[model samples]
Target chain A: MYGIRHLHLRNPGSWSPFEELERLQASLERGGVALGGASAGPAIDVWNEGDGLRLRALVPGVKPEDLEITVEGDALTIRGTTAVAGPQSGDRWLLRERASAKFARTLQLPFAVEADAVKARVANGVLEMELPRSAAEKPRRIPIQTT
Target chain B: MNCEMKNGCATVAEPTVAKATPACDVWEGEDGVHVVAEMPGVDAAAVEITIERDVLSIRGKACLPRASSRAEGEMDAVATGYVRAFHLTDTADAGAIQASCKDGLVRLLVPRKQPAQRKIAVSTG
Candidate 1:
């Protein structure tokens, strides 16, 4: 949706050249749908944490109850609808710029995360999510045996 | 709606002090005029609304979260605040205005005053 406008392609060390091609292909497909002007979603900011990743999405005028978040594999999806009440039959509108529509955005995480450990909260129309890295993906120290 | 005088002087002073103007929508109906503005990341306590004569003003500061230690070079610091004002007309009843904020959206209702109707007496001559 509209939030993808701020997607920064940082050097995520894990992706291979072949995976990059697949990601480019998927982004092109998403661009095709986004160009239709169906839904201009909210703005989002993604940042890298030491042991995890954090995401913040701005969705004003949308109720928390209407949001649906799902994590599948390495992808995180957020779906929600903003509904504004229609004007009455006899009412004449002076201005009508506000829009109401359904939006869905999916982002591929750089590393595998603990699905159950993910934390999310909605405050002041901003959705904040913290995805902790999986145990297997965390760095560990290995001991060396002297000959 | 005549906002100018014969001397070519503007009656209302233009608002040029806002750092960032937020998106706003105004609707007119039988009840009166309703205004909705989007102010994401702003808390209700930080919002300020005032009405001086025919001018309605809105100002708020966005409470953005600080960057984590690991995101020193990855994130950019940008201003995400809003300030806006509107010149109202005589049709608006400034005294009866009401406002509320929820989900980072502020809604203002300004009720219109009803015009007084005069009764005329008729007699057969």
Candidate 2:
């Protein structure tokens, strides 16, 4: 059976529900805060394949040439910037909820991976990456000897 | 925190329902009104746009890849479905609406209908 698993590693130390609530309340009290400044990391999804892992990230408005990916040992890092269109002279922004800024995310793999075998592709603003396991990490069986 | 046993392994409780409202930007230009929606992980073929009367609805489903092995550790998962709707004004020409999806972004164009101008004749009595 094909199974899919996700690994979520968020900065727990810096985030709290109470703090988020307080910030929301403060923004409401101040009428409205200016958009931007806050850099929330993009959403990412990881899949644990038998011999490798797959990662998908949402990066709308980001060009393929702007993305940079690196894999070293068990750490995989992705960095990119989303272009923000300049406002036209006569145009007024009614709403601006989509985030636009330079963002970086690094994920720690559960096991070592083959850096050379990694492949990545971007389509429709989503980035997909495949990381293969190292030769030594493949499962092996040992035979018992009876004396 | 809630936990459940799935396939003999204890797993964190996951929200069964996916309720993701995609972010959107609406603006009017000299040509027409434009609506841009950000829907990540959604393919161009999976996007569905429908217009009924004055209501315009957009729906998209993301087909995330599957893994062969069970996953461990804690990770946040993105919603796979997106939905949003907008109301069109009387000046909007629904028949001329056009939509395009690219790089996980969907753009819709709604052209405005021009009102006919008439010159009234003035009679001097």
Q: Write the per-residue lDDT of candidate 2 for residues A9-123, one digit (tens) a residue.
A: 2223334669668856643442221234534446676777657888877787788998989998888878888775533667545445566677776677877889899999988
In terms of lDDT, which candidate is strongest?
Answer: 2
Candidate topping DockQ: 2
Please tell me how candidate 1 rates in CAPRI terms. Answer: incorrect
Backbone clashes for every candidate come to 1, 6
Task: State the DockQ, from 0 to 1, for candidate 2.
Answer: 0.20
Against the correct fold, how does model 2 do in TM-score?
0.72
B24-109 in candidate 1: lDDT tens per residue? 66666678777777787778887888876656777667776655554432232233766656666767777788888778787887
| CA lDDT for candidate 2 | 0.66
Estimate, for each residue in A45-109, the C-alpha lDDT of model 1 and write its tens digit: 66777688887877778888988888876787788887776467776555556687787776677
